[model samples]
Target chain A: MGTRNKLIYLLAALGGLLVIRNLYVILLQFPDEAAQGAIYRIMFFHVPCWFICFTAFLAAGVASILYLWKRRMVFDNVAVSAVEIGVVFTATGLVTGSIWARVIWGIWWTWDPRLTWAFITLLVYLGYLMLRRAIDDPTERAKNSAVLCIFAFVSVVITYKAIDWWRTQHPGAVLSFRTGGGNIEPAWEMMLLWNFLALGLIAAAVLLIRLNQEQVRREVDGLRRRVHEL
Target chain B: MRFLRQAGTIAVKDLKAELRTKEAINASLSFALVILLLFSFAFDPTAEQTREISGGLLWLVFAFAGALILNRSFSREQANDCLDILVASPVSGAALFIGKAVANAILILAVEVVCLPVFGVFYNITWTKRPWWLLLVLVLATWGLTVIGTMFSALTVNLRLRELMLPVLVYPMMIPSLMAAMQLTTLLIAGEPVTGEDIVWLRLLIGFDIIFTALGIGLVETVLVN
Candidate 1:
């Protein structure tokens, strides 16, 4: 394997080990009563997935701004790759959230504000992908989809604030390290930080791989077009 | 001042064309009325539930109608290759955006005025109780919708599935605005006292309008150029 491929494989293996460690802590080591018992184990996967999804979306927004500013196709590819990874993480978050809800709330789904807004976020990005597919011209597609990504970012801000504006059953935020009084114990905090770092690295690795694939596909298409012209 | 003059000319040109054709107004108003009628029948106009849901119903109709109007607002510009002409002109993209937004707001407001009385008749609700407040809410909410709608309409004008794409792009962003408007209107219709919370919602709406208007102004050049 080339040096780059070897490096990626090492990172991928490290990511896998971290995930395995997370499962071990949740299932065998950590006390069941830590988050109200064994039921809370879902947080090990769910919370990190959600955090990674939002981070990916924020990255997509930044990439979109860069694409619009520089008119670079690479930035557009980065934006699309980030969003596609975001969708995967979002789906993972949704399914894990459903399982958590079933165990805790005794139901699979409720119109609870957080759940509803999560669904809305999913739909909005799905619509973004559909909009990209509907347009044929590459430059036009990039411009339109960049605008959409920016708009979706703005909409997320509004949606996040909506629950506070209207009274809803969704619980207020749990962890706020920024405010300096995170209620989590030191051990749990360490585990959480490890999980977050590991998952974030995994998400970045996936985005890079997808971006490379997109570049290769674009190059192949260009070659085909050139051959046709000849 | 120069930009305003150019924008005014563009606005006037769109108004004159719309006046001669009357296509956008007719299609949007008819579609809105049909939605209202369907809601009336589906919800049982005489039920207490209908009274409670009237605010949501009205906003839903307006949202659909607004999308329809927005979709068509730019299609003609694209069809006649007038968008190319507009872009080539010395007018700033921001000015063009304002021109289109103002024209669309006027069209949507006209539809609301016509539909409001029809709604009252069909649903048997009295309209005279809080006319000023209701109108105020309508104007503010519609203003916010039209501004964002016009910007997206311009952005999506070049897309293949313009009709389906506009609403998918717009409605999710408009949810907070629609929710706030619906809640405020519900209070007004029920003769409940408007509280400080209502003002907070109004401020949210205004904030959305300002932020989106600024973003639209900044990015419209990008949209127009490519």
Candidate 2:
């Protein structure tokens, strides 16, 4: 296999192992039996998805800034790809969150601060995609979409802090070493960290694969247009 | 200063053309009146309901009118290729934004002024108390609204779906401003004392204004360069 393909496979295997490890831990040794029980199992998947989404969006913002500064179409492509992946992960997070909420809070949706902010983040990116479709010129589209990505990033900051700014019932800092006080059990903590790393790596791998595919599609379309014109 | 002069020239040009045609103002005013009438008919229009919703209705009229005005504000420039002239000139983007914002603010405020009194008459609401507070909310919120609206309008002016895209893009960003404005307006109309909660919204309004204004100024060049 090519080097990249081999690396992707390795990462995929590692991710699978991490997921299995998390499942094993949850099945064996969760602290709470009554409050968490089977529902606590969802936390491993849901929390990591949200973390990946947040990381992806922050990367998109950085890519947008780089694109605007360097005037590179590659940076724009990367930004757009990152945003698309972020949206997917965000959707996964939202769905998983809703399921967890349904089990825990007895409601499918709550105006909990975190949930509202998450929904707003989704809308902001949705708006970004709409803005892209609305503009036609390739250069204008790149520039405008870059600016919009940056603006949406600003909004995300506001949304993220809205919980802290206005008090709501969403739990704060799920796994903070500084604030959560007592150390988590070493086994659970190790499993959690490994799951996070694995999912983060997988998210990066998916983004890279999608970016390559988009680039190739663009090149092939360009070649076809040229052939037709000739 | 020179940029401001050029901006003023552009603003005056727009105002004069608008005054001469009177098309946009008439269309917007008539539209606002129709909306007010529709709301009055649709709602119970009893004293209680009217008092509760009048501020909201007035702001709603302003928002719709502002959208219409934004959609049309660039028409004169587009029709006569004035944007190219402005771009070629030495006018700063901030100045251009401010000038356009000024014109939009005036047009929307005019519509609001005309509509508010008519609304008061229709709803039997008193405006004599807390006029300053009401004006303060209107000015701050509308400034924020028009600044963002004008920037987006300029950004989308060259798009194929300019008409549809403007509001779609503008409304989402305007949410915080709209919420704050509506809350403040509701408070004023109800004659509630301005408390810490109201100040929070006021601060939000100010924050939105500063951030968006800076964003518009910084990004306008990028928008117009292409």
Candidate 3:
């Protein structure tokens, strides 16, 4: 009944409807490609996961900077929530990409520049989480992890630039759909955007839930400290 | 001027302590040598393949042995609560961080200097060609390692699992610099000329060193203050 809960339900319902509609088009309505066939359809889910991952990580980095600048617990909470969600989406992106690779590329994995950077990015953020678990004090945890978060974002930028710096076998983005460039069919491109919108809504709902959980965690910690004093 | 002096003094203080005991240097040098010998037994040192991988092997030794040296940069302050004293001192956190990073770089560079030749001897590769270029790569790459290593050392110094956490946090960040360093070192070790594309790796190395150095100095105050 709370406003936050109601918002979550609204977003989830909207996202679910869009997802069902997109799936109907993808599985039934849309025609197969000339070259890669139905297998290439995984790009609908695969690319959006990366989009969400990058978006969440960018949010985490900005929140980290805000936390360090303002000394606000709210910013730290946002940073941690964004990073946790970013990590899950990054894992999803990797899994989906790997399955696609197994079918298309004839191997489960390759050390192509993008793939290599993706794996390293996964490790780096996982390290960020581990660093968080290692510290006890809430303030220290926030400060230290914020610092690491900034460094991790730099690595992410380096990863993105790395694809340009090195030759990559991974297919380049078809996002030039806006300018009407690239080889993608117009229909596939439209479906991609629809799926992204749905996924983004779902991810936002999850983020709100995560923020609420973090609020509860802080409250519990406050109560435990008070109990210790009593 | 005072800030530079403060930084210099801290650097000298650590170098003097390291000189007195030589514990880290001794352990690291021996560890580096042992790894080199083990690498020789594992790979036929004289093989054509060995030359291709020698750069990677040499840096791996430095990285592993360097971890031993870097871990002490801040944890040494924990003894007698010296971290508190240093933080309370007139020197700023930036100075403390730079000084410690500088000292760590010097220490690791010394180990690398010794290990490089030993690595040459063990692997039967002539690393003496273009000594100046090799030194430049070593300096840039070593500075890159210590900057992140020392910063993370400070970040994790107070943690319960400091040793375990430092490497996990630091190594992923080091990959870019390490990749650049490895490629340049591999090419240099083989006495090849630096072509246009190889120049990118060197630029990346310098960029990494500069970026992390600035970040370390800017943020150390937050990390050091309780």
Better model by DockQ: candidate 2 vs candidate 3: 3
Each model's DockQ score: 0.72, 0.62, 0.88
Leading candidate by lDDT: 3
- Tens-digit lDDT track for model 1 on B113-199? 998889889988765578888888888888788877888888788877888888887887777678778877777777666677677
List TM-scores for all candidates, in order.
Answer: 0.94, 0.90, 0.97
For model 1, residues A1-230, the per-residue Cα lDDT tens digits are 76756666777778888888877887899888654678777777787887788888889999999998899999999999999988898899889988888878888888865777777888889888988898877888899889889878875565456556656665554555533657666677677778888888787778778877989988997898899999
Candidate 1, position A194, lDDT = 81
Which regions of candidate 3 fall more than 4 Å away from where they truly are? A177-180
Model 2: per-residue Cα lDDT over A74-107, one tens digit each: 8888888899988998899899888988888888
Error of 1 at A88 (Å): 1.6
Question: Which residues of candidate 1, in runs, are more than 4 Å off?
Answer: A159-167
By TM-score, how accurate is candidate 2?
0.90
Native-to-model Cα distance after best TM-score fit, residue A8 in candidate 1, in Å: 2.7
> Each model's fnat?
0.74, 0.52, 0.85
Off by over 4 Å in 2: A31-37, A111-114, A177-194, B41-43, B47-57
Q: Please report, as a residue range, the 10-residue window in candidate 2 chain B with the lowest summed lDDT.
A: B46-55
